[model samples]
Target: MRIDLTSVFVDDQAKALDFYTDVLGFEKKNDVPVGDARWLTVVSPEAPEGPELLLEPSGHPAVGPYKEALVADGIPAAAFSVDDVHAEYERLRAHGVRFTQPPIDAGSVTTAVLDDTCGNLIQIMRVA
Candidate 1:
């Protein structure tokens, strides 16, 4: 099966939407309410608009643990491929993005990590 979607847990959906759209430049794909929360998704301009990142809630018990563990470890953010890591990094920084890790050579790929200002870090990467 093709990898059409991935998820990033957020404390709030509305806040996450602003960051993803306003800061990251990802267009909103859909916002479907599924019970107490919503099934929010966004897609990059480069992508076919089919694959989107599911912005799920961290309030649920099942995902709360997983989300906390990842955030606590200070691991890299959800990796997103960019045409030019350096350029993209600069663009984001100019937009007042707070970066925890600057763009650096990662052997095969150059990557950078930044806080989404919501709850989790976000990663931007490019092929080396």
Candidate 2:
């Protein structure tokens, strides 16, 4: 068994694309129109054929409250692996991205949390 795709609910697909691609460094994979929302997805530039991250719309009834609760509790909706958490965090902060939590060492791993601007908190991490 293997994972092919996963999703993060987003309030705005356009903004999500910009952040995920321009800021977070993911590459756009697929973008097909599906009614009011497009079937948007992104893949890591290092792994173009790997699992895709779907930017799903938050139009569903339960999505808003679920996202709100997650944010209220300071939880990240998704996590991306980086070679250096501190470097990535600094680079992102230089780009005007807002981080909810600064990079902190956690045993063999280090992580930082940032607001995705599309109504979700995302974590960037690295492992030692």
Error of 1 at 79 (Å): 0.4
- Structure candidate 1, residue pairs in collision: none
Model 2 TM-score?
Answer: 0.98
For 101-128, candidate 2 gives per-residue lDDT tens digits of 9999989999999999999999999988
The best candidate in terms of lDDT: 2
* Model 2 CA deviation exceeding 4 Å by range: none
Q: Please give the range of 10 consecutive residues that has the lowest summed lDDT in model 1.
A: 62-71
lDDT accuracy of residue 53 in candidate 2: 100
lDDT of 1 by residue, 1-128 (tens): 89888998888999999999998989999899899999999998677457889888888677766656766887754888888988988999999999888989979989889988767877888885
Count clashing pairs, candidate 2. 0
Question: How does candidate 2 score on lDDT?
Answer: 0.97
Model 1 spans with C-alpha error above 4 angstroms: 62-65
lDDT of model number 1: 0.85
